[model samples]
Every structure is written in C-alpha cells, then in structure tokens.
Target chain A: MKNVFRFLYELLIGKPEPPMETPLYRSEIFPDVGGVSLLLITLVLVLVYYYVLNHVMRTARFSHWYHWLGMLLINAGIAFGYAIYYCRLHEVTPDSYVYWFAFANAFYSALFFFLFSLLLKWRSYNAARTPF
Target chain B: MAKLFIFGIGGTGARVLRSFGMLMAAGVDIKADTVIPIIVDPDTQNADLNRTVEMLKSYKRLQGVAGHDSGFFKTDISKLADMDTRGEGRVKDAFTFDFGGINQSFKEFIHFNEMDPDTQALVQLLYTQDNLNSPLTIGFKGSPNVGSVVLNKLINSPELRFFADNFRKGDRIFIISSIFGGTGAAGFPLLIKNLRNPNSGLQNAGEISSAIIGAITVKPYFGLQTENESVIDSNAFITKTRDALAYYKNNLHGVNGLYYIADNPDTPYENRPGGASQRNDAHLVEVLAALSIIDFMDYQDADFGEETLFHEYGLRQDAPSITFEQLYEETLHRIGQQMVKFQLFAKYYKDMIREDAGKNYYKALNLDAAFANDSFHKELRHFLENKQWGYFAWLEELARNKRSFAPFNLSTQDLNLLVQGKPVSRSFFNKGITQDGFVVRLNKEERNLTSEANPNRKFLKMFNHVTEDFYTSKMPGI
Candidate 1:
C-alpha cells in the first residue's frame, strides 16, 4: 500500500519537495494521506450519498447528476485539505512539491468517488438511476 | 367470467354510464369479466350521450394499452357489436343503438294522416295539437305517451336481436333510466317486458328471459328552468314521477333486482328538451346510481329469490355537502380507497409530471419522450384533464351541483390536505406526503415493477403501487 501510494503521487507531481525529505514522504505521508483521504474518506462519502441520504432517509431531492457531482467535489476538497494538514503536521520542508502532492490527492479522490458511486448505487432506492 | 350488459336508456342513463366508466377507470372492483354498455338514446345529437361515448372510447383505448392485470383500467368495457365472436357484423360497431333516424313528426310517424274518419276522431281526442305536431327528431319532449308507442318498436330492432344472440346464461343485464323523463320512463318497462318474454323469437331468448336482470330507476333529482315556450315544465316533474312509480309498482316486473334513487331538486337546469344544448352538470345521484350497478354485480346467483329484491340508497346523515366520512361503511368499502388512489394519480399527472422529468422513475422509463410523443400518455392526459368532460371536469361538476359530493380538496396544491376531512398527519421528521416523497416512492415502485415489460402497463402499475403506499402510510383512518 505504501509503494502504491508513493507511485501514484510521484507519477503526478514527480519527486518530493526537498531531496532530504524524500524518505519521510515515501515512508509516511504518501500512504497516510492516500489511504485516509482518497480511498477511505471517498468511500465513506459515496456510501453516505447513496445509502444514507437516498436509501435510509429516502430523499429524492438529492438524487440528481448535479448532486452527485457536488458530493464528488466535496470529497476532493476534503482530500486537498487533509493532505495539506497531514504534511504540515509532519513538519516537512516547506516547498512547492507538498502543494503538488495535495493537488494529486484531490484528483485521485474524485476518481475514487466516481468508482465508489458506480459500485454502490445500484441498490439505492431513489438514486439508483441518478448521475447516469 | 360472466359479462354485465348495461342498457343506458336516455340522458340520465348516459350520464350514469359516464360515472360508471369513471369508476371502472379508477380500478374499482366489479365482479363481471367484461361490461357491455348499450346506450339507447334516439336523440343522436344529445351532448350527454356524445360525451359519454367519447370518454368510453378514450377509456377503451387506455385499457387496450394497459392490460387487465394493471390496477387502473382493469375492467374491459366492450361495445355491444364486439360481442359477435363470429364476425357476423349484424350490428353497427358503435356504443349506441342504431335508431336509423326518426325524422318524421309523431303524427306522421303514427300515420294519423292516413287514418279513417272514425280513427282520426279518436286520435284527436287522445292527443293534443301540440303533442300531435311535435317532431320526433328532438325526442318525446316530456311526453311518455308518445315515447311508449315509439319505443315499443325497440323489441324488433336489430341490436336487441344481436344482444339476445350473444348473451350467455350466466351473464347479467342492468338497465339505467330516470323515472321523470320521456325516453327512460317509457323505455325501461318495454325493455323489461321484451327481455322477459321467453317466446320472443331471438336466438337465446330462454337464457335472457331467466337471466338476473337489475334496473335502477333514478327518480326526479333535478328540475328544468321555467321557459314559457318550452314543453317541459318543472312543476310536472313530481307528477310525472308519481305516475311512473304507480306504473312501475304494478307493471315493472321481470327484474330480479330493482333499485330506486332520488334527491330533492335544488337548482333548475336549462329547459332544453333534447339536443346538444341539453347537457346537465353531473350530480351525486348519478354517481350513487352507478354504484348500484357495482352492488348488483356483487350479489351471488343464489342471493336472488323468486321475489324481486328492492334497494334504496340513504346516506348516514342528510347534508348539503358530502365527504368520505358521511358515507356508510358499505359504500366506503365499495369505492373509497380506489377513488382516492385514482385521484392521487390524476393530481400527480396533472400537476407534477412536468417537474419530474429528471426523476429516477421518469428517466428509467424514458418518460420525457413518452410524455411528449406517446398516444397512451396523451389519452391519459385527456382522460384526466380535458376541459370539456374529463375526470377533473366531472369532479368539478359534482362539486358545483346540488347536494355536492366534494370529497377531495381539489383547489389546494398541498397533497397533505387532499382528502377533505382526512388530512395527512405530519410530524417534525415526517413531511407526510410531499412531491419529493412521492417521487421517492415512485422510484422504489419502479424498481419493483421491472418485470413488467410494457412501458404503459409499468407506468400504471407503478402509480398504483405508489398511491397504495401513500394511502396506507400517510392517510390515517381512511
């Protein structure tokens, strides 16, 4: 999981911010941000949109393509903010590479959100055909 | 699988049949496998008859698209001519009986001009000058003496013979006519007499003679406006009803079940004898009279005895306006929920379908193109919202007429307060019945109805399920 996160972030933004911080970036920040923000948090937002708001509460107001897009944007925003917060918490070298990594995380968060929606929306009563 | 042949005899009969058609469109339960409505009005230009025919045609088209298993349009209403399985083409393929146009005056029709001197003297004594000169094209003009003689020839008509030929032993016959008018007051007894004659030479005369025959004679429910030049006088309605009752008590036989209904006259309708102008607003009496047809079909064959069973409708309490709570339990059981469901379906179609273009259920069925281009949707729209004589217009007529039957709060846009006396209970968490909730329920029902292949059938079935859920969950004490 760590190598996979390292490969995804590096593929988008190239190397880490400073040559001295490369090991910390690969060892902790990449995996921590990618797993929590992109995969886990995106999955949770998709489930809340499809299952909780639609099926459990049975609301049709949010069962639209635009509403789904809004949820995806929100997940991306959360990923962007979490990546910046995690990087600062680690006291990494202040550079443009950290911002680039957060940008990559936000982009991947949107993709994961779309993937999760397709997987979980079929069983939703009100939003099954939404965003089609 | 017995069929019910309904003979609607005049203007009142046509209006009652219209109400019955509305009920059948709402998926109200009827015991018969098929219903054959034979409208028997000689006034071909009558507005009431024309409107009933048009509504029945629309209903037949929708029923063709949505099969019997779907809740709405569940019953099959067939034309009398369609019953000829052999394709004999003996009768006209129409809802009304072919009268062949009685274009002559009554005097000319009876051949009084060619009578001998002694016969002419007797005819002059029996008929007034106005009665003798009245044209047959407009109808009897409140004169049953002329109608009785004219309608007696009905027994020899080709439609009667065709009806007799197709009637099976288990099938039942129902007749609807008013006791205060000319055509119905005169035609009802003649029809009963002919159908009861076992020796009548028709093919299945024996079966038809012993069949379970029911008739609802609607008494005077509305009066005519006073017109100095008009032959129909409002003052004579009670006298005519009294005379007809006396005649019916002694001479109206062969009916296994006889039902009588009436209401006090409140407003006077225009005194148009019989033409396109003679259209009257629908009344509660007609709707209840239509219910009698359903009630008659509910009885088992063994329920009928040698004596003719008689019935009269009475409300729980007499009021100028009636709601669901005012009806008896039996009446409510017969039609309450079905009417409410159909009304919901109609209201949604009229008010919310346009806004629901992006709904899951709407997109699943591709209702955007269907609503814009499909004939089924167009017919459904016409059935519910047409300005002249559609379902909403029928409801409005009922509400504005004397002794109003306004059970639904039609003017309000709020779905929670739809039923007049039975409002949906709402809570902080539960908005009882909103447009959003309706769409949600419809989406759920659409998923459940995936197995129904036809879009028209699925549309009706989906609404049926959704409205049923709303009725059960949202409306309490219904």
Candidate 2:
C-alpha cells in the first residue's frame, strides 16, 4: 500500500532522483531525470496547451492583433513549466551550463505560438477576404 | 415591352391601385414591363384618388433612382402622358385624369334649368332632385345614375386615345372598381363597353377593343362611421352588390379574367370623401384582389376561354382572424414569404437601423449620408409614414384586422420576434436570431458588387437580394 501510494505521489508531484539506468535519462537534454516520466509530463503539458489554445480561439474573435499574443503567452507559460520540471528533476543548480540549457528549452514554446498564430492569421485573412 | 394598362375606376379602385403599388414596392411579381395606371374618377378632390396618384409617383421616383432591372419596384408605372416621352420627369405628372368641367352640380352639368319644359320633366323622372343638385367635386355619392352620365366621357378622352395609340400586341388591360359605389359601378361597364366598341376612334381601335382584359370588382367590406345625408350608406351595400352582380352576369364583356372580393363588415373606417381623411386600412380582401392580378398574369392566353375566368379568394380555413397557418399553402408560398421578408426589411429601416447606420454594411452601400439628414432619407420616411397609404401603416392595419396574414411576430416589446416558423431555440454558435439577425443575414446575402453608386439603388438591391436569401433560409421551400 505504501509503495502504491509513493508511486502515485511521485507520478503526480514528481521527485528528485539519481541518474536512471536508461540512456534517455542520461542524455544531454535531461541527464538526471527519468525519461518515461519526463515524456509523460511533456505529453500532458502539450495536451493542456492545445486545450487552452482551442478555448481562446473559439471564444475570442481575431479582430485585434493582441488576441494572438495572448494565446502565445498561454502556450509559452506551459512550455516554461516543462523546462522548470526538467531542471528540478535533474537537480541542475541555477549557475550551471546545463541549467541554462534546460531553461533555453523554454524557447520551444515559440513553435506553439508560431503554429497557433499562423493558423489564426490564416483564418483572419480568409475571413477578411470572405464577406460575412 | 408588354404593358398592363390598369383602369382604377373610382374611390375603391384608387385604393386597390394604392395597395398594388405597395405590393410592387415589396417586390411582388406584377408580370408587366410597364404598369400604366389610369385613375378614372370625376371627383377631382376625392382623397383616395389623390393619395393613390401621390403613391404611384413616389413609387416612380424610388424606382427611378433605384438601378435598372432591380427586383424592388420591378414594375415600372409611368403616367399616361409620360409614356410618349423618353425624358420622363416629375412626380406631379399626375396619374389621375383631369375631371374638367364636371365638378359642378349634376343639374349644372346637364344644363337642367335651361332645358325645355318637356326635357326637364323627363330629367326629373330619371334622377332624384338631390341627385341632380348634389355637387360632383366629391363624387356621385352612391348615385350610379348620376355617375353613369359623368363617367361616360372618360372613354373618349385624349388620355384613352393616347393609351390606345401606344397599346402593343401583347399588352393587356385590367380594371378595378367597387360594385356598391357610384363611380366604380357606373365606370367599369362603361369603360368595357367603349373598349369593345367597333369604332373607338383611336389609332389601334381593333386591337384595343379586343385586348385581353382582367378586372376586380370589390364588394362592400366595411361600414361607415356615420351615415351622411347625400352620401353612401352601408345598409344598402348588399342590395347594390346583388343588383350589380346580376347586371354583370348578363352584360359584362370584353374581360377575359374577372375576380370578386368582399369581407364581412367587421371593421369600419372613418368616413371622409375628399382630402386626407379618406385613407382606408390595408385589408385581406384587397391584398387577395392584388394577388388575383398576379394569377391573371400567370395564366397563358390559351387558358382563358370565351367566357371570363371567374376567381374568388379562398382561405384554407374560415376564421374571423387568420394567422399564417390558416392561409393556403400555395398562398403562403407565393406571397407570405415575400410579405414577411419585406416587413422585416421595412422594420429594420424604421426601428432598428439607427445604431447600425455607421456599420460597414451601411457605409459600403453609401447609405450613411442619406440616413444623416438627406432628402432621400426623407423620401424613404415618407414612404413609410405617409399617414394613409404607407408601408408601416399598411402592415399594422393588416395585422390588427380580421383575416390577418400574421406572418411576422411583430411587437412593441420584442425586437427578437421570429418570422412565423423561425426557430426560437439557439443554433450551434448563434445566440438565437433577433431582428439584428436579419441585418447579419443581409450582410451575408448582399452581393459584393460596387457598380451601382446610387444610395437608393444600393439599398434596394441589397435588401432585395438579402430578403430573398433570408426567406429561403427560413422557409426551405421558398
């Protein structure tokens, strides 16, 4: 019962650990974290990002340019959280190169914004061409 | 171009012609290239006649500014004189013929006092003293005997000759009159008899005499507020109608199509003979009478037999007050949708368009200046609020009356009222449609063309396109 409880707690809140046996865990991207757990967390974050992006697009009309920015900020916030989780799980101190490298992974969130804004722009352009 | 020369015979005739103009404005199919309305009434001061002439002129002005071949005001009605001129202009061209030298007492018209004693004695035997002495400036006042003499000169007039001279091969004639009244009853048969005469002394007498003809004889549908002494009486309407119908059964000729319309006298209008007080509410009978013209045009010439094709308006169910459901499916399909759509368009301009005047749609259509203090806007307002025969008043009266065509769920409270069967429940992304929904739908349906720069034309064309789409969307069968 304790083992089950511990596993669930670790899966949800996550835990610090020594390097795992898998090469993915020992890879340059996230050297001290468990590869499976990191993948699971990233998958969940991508889903959450997609869900929030959909909600904004559905509710907010693309009349103003700022709506696209607002959507980007939401996705960037989620991507930044993924970087912070990697830093915590890998035990990378703030001053190290790996710490900055993992933090730089936050820029990946730009892809989400780029793809999101592109879709939004395309929809708005088509809408402008097409009469109501 | 085939023209439909409509002879609106008297006060009832003038009123029905006014309803026909209103129908034409709403984009009803009149099936004529030009509609030449010749109002035949000896009463120069008759209110209904003057009002109808004024309305026909307004319709002309609106159609003039509206682009060529627009669905709105598709039927072009020119004055009898202007039909000869290409550079036609002005509203005061006058649709009514000048009664001229006939506005005096019937006694003066016949030179009763100067006649020999033997002739005077014969005139006394033929006409009552009051009938002879009564002034004709207002009308014959239910005295068809007096009306017969005054209206007979119409067939020989310069206007009739001009009309006959221009009459083409495929051109047709339709007459409107009331069976119970003086002028209409007397003038209808006289006009027909003269047209059928072998020698009308016009340029195309043979063709004009044998022309395909349609007529609507309106029976008494309302009572007078108070009976006047030398005026019409509602009590005698049935007896007059019976006598007239009996006469028509034997003598009515030269007409290929005939329509009869009457309503139970449930709502009586305020009685007035001349000037502004003579406007009557739009009735179901008159609207159906107007529809008979449409049906007449729809029939091929071969369908008309030697005897006149007689038609009477009927409802799906007999009710004192009718809703959209009580109308025949064919009636609903033909006119119900167009009426509702135009009502919505009119209401949008009347009630809901002020805030929206600054929108892209208004700006694109160039209506911003017109809606802002322009003469065109004033003309539009006059078309809507012209005390007696305006669009808004017509719809309101039709709605309140018995045998209503309650197609729109109109109200003082709800701006969001749906057209009869439109869904009240919201669709996927749309909050249920309000009157604003019509404007939104209009935006979708309006053509993207910018060629016609006249604001009035743009407004008319856009609405004509939009209402068609709006109705078709609402009623799938439409």
Candidate 3:
C-alpha cells in the first residue's frame, strides 16, 4: 500500500505531492444551498401574501372576490419581477431602470379598471334591489 | 416732438418690447416726450394683453405723451383678404385699429406721467416674424405671408407721413433689425427707402442728416443638420430669407452705420439646430438689437450735433451701404451671437469638468455652466440658471401661465416625470402631458429626437410663445 501510494504521487504534475489522504466529498453541494435559499424565499412570499390578505380583510376595501384576485395577480407580477431581476440578480442601473420601466402600469390598470367597473355594477344592482 | 413706436412682429419680438417698454418707463426718464411706446401687434385681443394694455393706458403720463402728438399711424392692408388670416378683419386686425384704444387712452396716461411727444421721429417694431404668419404646429399649418402684408400696411399709412414731417434738421433716426427672417428683412428696405427719400417718409423729411440701423442676423448655426428635413430643408424659404436680407443690406448700405451677429455653428444639438442654440440666439439677437437703439445714459454722440427732437412717422430711408450680415464677423458681440457661442461651448465640453476627480460642487459652480458637462440637458438647465434669458425661463413661464386646470390622476411617479428631465415630446407638445407612466418611463430617451427635446423648432416655439404673450399680457413674476 505504501509503495502504491508513492508510485501514484510520482505521477502528479503541477503541485507538490499531497501530504494526506484525499477525501471524496465536497464541503457543500450547490443544489442543497440553492434549495434552502428557495425555501426561505417561499416562506417570505407566503408571509407577505397572508399579511396583505389580513390587511385587505380588515380594511374591507375590496368587498368582492374579483378585487382580491386582481390585487393578487398584480402583486404576483411585482413579486416575480423582484425575485427574478432584483432579489436574485441584485441589479441596479439608471439606464436599465429609467427607460422601459412602464410595466407596472399594466397590472395597475387592470386592477383599477375592474374595480371601477365593479363599483358601477354594484351601484346599479343596489338601486335595482331598492326600486329607486 | 419725440415719438416712441414699438411694433412687435411675432411672439418673441412682442414680449421683448413689453420688457423694453417696462424698462423704459422705470429706467429712462423721458420728459416732454412720449412716455410709452405705441405697441403695435396683432395679438391685442388676447385677454392677458388687454389687461396689460389697460394698465399701460392707465398711466397718467401716457395721456400727455399722446396728447402732444395724437394720431394713429394705422397700417393699410392694400387688400381686405390680409385681415382674415388669423380670424379677423383688417379694420379690427390692423395694428392701428387694435391699438387705437390704447392710443386714445394716452390722454390719461400722459397726463399722469406728465410727458409729451417731443419729436415723433423714430419707430421700433418688435413684431418679429418670418416672411409670413408662421404657425409652428407640427404640420406647419396656418402660416400666411404676413411680412408682405404688414410691410404694405405700414408703407401706406398716412400717419407715417405725418410723423415724418416732424423730423427737423440734425435729427437722427435709427431702425434696428436682425437679418434673420421676414419682418425685419422686409421692414429694413421699407424703412431705409422712406427714411432717405427726399419725398416724405420722415416727419420733416429733410431734417434727418444721419441714421443708424443695427441688425443681429444669426447666420445658420450648423447644428441644424439634425432637425426635421421638412422644416430645415426648406431651401426655398431660406433662400427667400437670405436674399431678402441681402437686398436690404445693399439698399441700406450707404445710408447708415451697420453692425451684425454671426451664428456659432459649433453648438451641440443633441436633437438638432434651432433649440438650445438657434432660438435662444434669435431672442438674444432680437432683444439686444432692440437695446442697441437705446441712446446710452451718458452717450452723447458729438456727431449728432445740435439735434432737435422731431417725429417721423411715414418717411423711411433707402437701404444703406452695409447689411447687418456683412458686419456679423466683426465688432458688436450681440447678445444673440454670444448666446450661440455659449451654447456651442456647453454642447461640446459640458461633461468634461463633471468627470474630473478633483472637481467639487464649488469648483463646478465656478465653471461656465453651459459647458461644464457633456449632457446637453444638464447644460441647458445650467445655461438657464446662469442667464435668466434662456429657454428655461420661457418654458417655466409657459407651463405656469398655461390654463391647465383639468383634474388629472397623477402620482409621484408622474409628477416626477413632468418636472423631471425629458426630451421635448411631440406627443406631449401642447397636450400638456400624457398621463401614463409607461409611456413616459418606457422610452430610453423618454422622447424621440424630433418628438422630444425640440432641439430644433420646439425651442424656437417657446420663444415665439413669449413673444405672443408679450403683446397680450402683463408680465408674470417667474
């Protein structure tokens, strides 16, 4: 065994021969670290969702399910952008941000448009029920 | 016997005159002569202008000024069709008619100010326009050949002749024009012909021994290349303007002393010519040209010699031996010319000092702001900050005065955008501003070259607006 080790060491090229026996495993695997990071992110996202839900319920600002759904969609879009571009990549640039920063309008307009439409519809339905 | 006649040709000209008139009243104390210049302009009907006119009319000295020499030198449009262009008739549209009430109001103003028309010998037209009534909408709509129309009107007025009769021996007359466009170009010849003519353009036609006319004609600033081909490439228009100026110079060459302003072609146009450099230069030239005619407080021209105050309404001299354009390369660093130079400097080197590691805010502040940074936008802002007369002041005034009372759904993001730096947006030109954040924030430059910064005609349009406001309203504190 000692002779075999010495012969293998002789075959080494760049570095001086190792003084100790080599271990097979790396200190940490990238996939494990990545999964743990992803789990923490999901936990935070879930908390944010629940907090927003609780706040919405307390305020009663959105009485309808559609409004809640719309808000969720919009928030989701923002979260997606944050997670992919900002949180994960950690990017900050005036040039990258200044122009073409108009994506937020889509989500906002969609939610607002539906809310306003629902408000109008609700008024009509209430009036019909009361026989004004 | 003295007359102060100020004619505002286009927008910039009129506004400058308003300031000039205000300055004259507050600064130069004219006794036994006209206190207020007779303001001639087409925008007399504007509500703001009427208010200003009423205020001017209320001046007690204004009455005495007119009472001493009170005849309206109304312009005569050879044809009735000329009056209908801007949606009015010549009887109502003409300067004489539009300002007639103010002329009548002089009875009260002059008495209050205690002044008289000593000699109605000189007249100044602040109405600067291209050869026509150039409406600067994107499509170049509503432009009529107002230059010829106005020229004909002035030449045919009987009051002009009556005024010329007032000029006595040793009296002097000065006509100032910047050799840029229509009104000045056309008016120069008309003024020279009548002034020098033995027949009867001046008050006392023979009394005028000498005349001094100055023009601050800005030659083409080379930055014009980036401008829209439709506007800048109109060679026919340019040639007409150029040739008319040339003719005026040749005609007036021998009759008077001359000075001029040349354009600094090196000015940067992040967008194009006529914006940061061109329009600013135009206003500076026009205003400085107006100031050039002001007799200095201590400046007694020995050559004027035993001058009697006389008024000349109708008589104009022929074109002289020198044109303002010919003198452009030499003496007279007219304000407009200097402004062009500064714009050029800022355009080229504004960014250099900003990048220097050792430069501090104090150090940066000491440098000429116009050229301290490479960014034209920053340079423009800097230029305006230093010189109150640049485009920044005018834009602020415009945004302030515009009657934008409509309720808008605005957010911090939106407000930041309106106040924030964006190019001159064609989309937003007169529409105030669009409401979408995406529309504003999405674009890389925020505005397309022609659509945004108005480095070309948009800047000039701002100057023109001031001119219009000048004739129409009282000065708003900026």
lDDT of 1 by residue, B219-316 (tens): 99998889999989979989999989998889888899999999999888989999889899889999999999999999999999889999999999
- Interface RMSD per candidate (angstroms): 0.9, 6.7, 24.9
Chain B: TM-scores of all predictions: 0.98, 0.91, 0.38
TM-score of chain A of 1: 0.97
Model 1, residue pairs in steric clash = none
- DockQ of predicted model 3: 0.01
lDDT of 3 by residue, B82-143 (tens): 22456433343223223233222212322423433442111113222231223321111112
Query: Best TM-score goes to which candidate?
Result: 1
Better of 1 and 3 by lDDT: 1
Candidate 3 backbone clash number: 103
Provide the TM-score for each candidate, comma-separated.
0.97, 0.76, 0.32
lDDT of 3 by residue, A17-132 (tens): 12221110011211222222223333343333333432222222232344445554554454335423432232223232211222332233334334433443222211111110
Off by over 4 Å in 1: none
For model 2, residues B1-478, the per-residue Cα lDDT tens digits are: 4888888888888878877888888777767888889888877777677777878888888777663466667678788777766644322357887676465799998899999999999999999888898888878887788888987778767777778878888899999999988889999999899888869777788888778999999998887776565266678889999999999989987789999988888866676654446666667777777787787887877887788888888788887766676778877766766676677677777877775543335544556666667766777778877776677777677778765655566674343354654434456665443545555544433435467666567677777776666566545532
- lDDT values, one for every candidate: 0.91, 0.68, 0.31
Better of 2 and 3 by TM-score: 2
